[model samples]
Target chain A: MKADQTLDCIGLYCPIPIVKIATKIKDLKTGEILEVVGDDKGIKLDVPAWCQATGHELLGIEEQGGEIKVYVKKAPN
Target chain B: MAKKEKLTIAVLSGDLERALAAFMLAVTGASMDMEVSMFFTFWGLNIVKKNEGTMKSKGLMKKMLNMMNRGGSKRLKLSRFNMLGLGTWMMKDLMKQANMPSIDEYIAMAKDMGVELIACTTTCGVMGISPEKDSFRSEVGSLAGAAYFLSEARKSGVTLFI
Candidate 1:
């Protein structure tokens, strides 16, 4: 799937990847998509929880090699 | 526009690790556009102390505790196996290896994200630490009672004690 932008959070740990996602999402327009790349242990739960809590849309999550990529669509206010 | 959900975290411990965890949550909460507030009480107050003039509770025991916990967030004792401060150093090194933010960096991130940092008024009194006299980091706002913060916590979507 395509995204408006990509955030590479590889090598980062819990809270950092999630925090970056939260910060990055603000720059996107409503309904725009952000692709997050990370492999943190918390990402499996944290990314989905973050989207659910913040009302963002989780498009999909795919694993490539050793990295996990999360696609999130910004939600309208 | 709809109202944003908020979180209130009550940091009740002075342990460096728990305080680090608390700040992580605060930053994450605020980053998602949620109003995040942190209430620091008892040992937790050490996290907000400035570089100098740490307050100690009266009596030798409390004084010794203060001596052990002198450096604020910069020099916090680990909750377990501190090893004469070596454990904290090892943990810092581990965090660096993982590309995680340091405790000081986490505090900075929470502040930058607009996390409301409030020191507990009663704890301040119990420790004989006058908020007006003893210095604290600029991140900390005016002191408040538990009742006030508890009220805020009650209205929050989630509240954590750590």
Candidate 2:
């Protein structure tokens, strides 16, 4: 999916990046995709858990060259 | 119109830096018109103590050690304290000099701003920290556990663990 907004949370640990992403997503319209790039190994689990808990849809997750990319689509409530 | 936001922060570290971060976030959230709730657990509960001495300052050497070992203030992570009293004193002084608000001020601001403060019941029970009749701001509420805070956090637009 094409992202309407991209967020780079690289170098941030567990809760900071997640908090930042959540705050960002809250400001976006439903169906807008937020692409998150981070280097924290825990983001692999943190992002998905946050999406699941918050009712947002995690479109995809990929790791390349030591960086993890997450695509999340804001779900309309 | 801009929609109102909600943020719930679970601050479980007992470290002074983490406590300051939690307070800062609480203040910021309130300033932004966000409904904010903070859950204090584990060592984080120390800040909610009735006694003024609960959040004290430490010595320079210990402060330096904490900075070196815990990655400094911006990290907002915990530092291991061999002697809790001295460390707390040092931390309180350092935070004071840095213009960081006291726990009392944070709680008062939170109260005036409608921020919720929830102490972790289980941690308090296990650690023998009492919350009853405390000087904790009148806005402070009863204790809760991780599950309670997490459930509340799940409903918030922003949830932070500091």
User: Which stretches of model 2 miss by more than 4 angstroms?
Assistant: A1-77, B1-3, B52-99, B130-139
Interface RMSD of each: 1.3, 8.2
Docking class of 2: incorrect
Give all candidates' CA lDDT scores: 0.84, 0.69
Question: Per-residue alpha-carbon lDDT of model 2 for A1-77, expressed as tens digits?
Answer: 47899898876654557657866887889988999998888889877776765678999998999999999998885
lDDT of 2 by residue, B50-154 (tens): 543231225565345333433212223336552645666776677666555666666676677678888887765444544353524346677777788878888
The digit string of per-residue lDDT tens for model 1 on B1-162 reads 668777999988989889988998899888677899999888898788876665645677657656665647886879898999899889888889889898788888888888888988878755545655245788786678879797988889989999
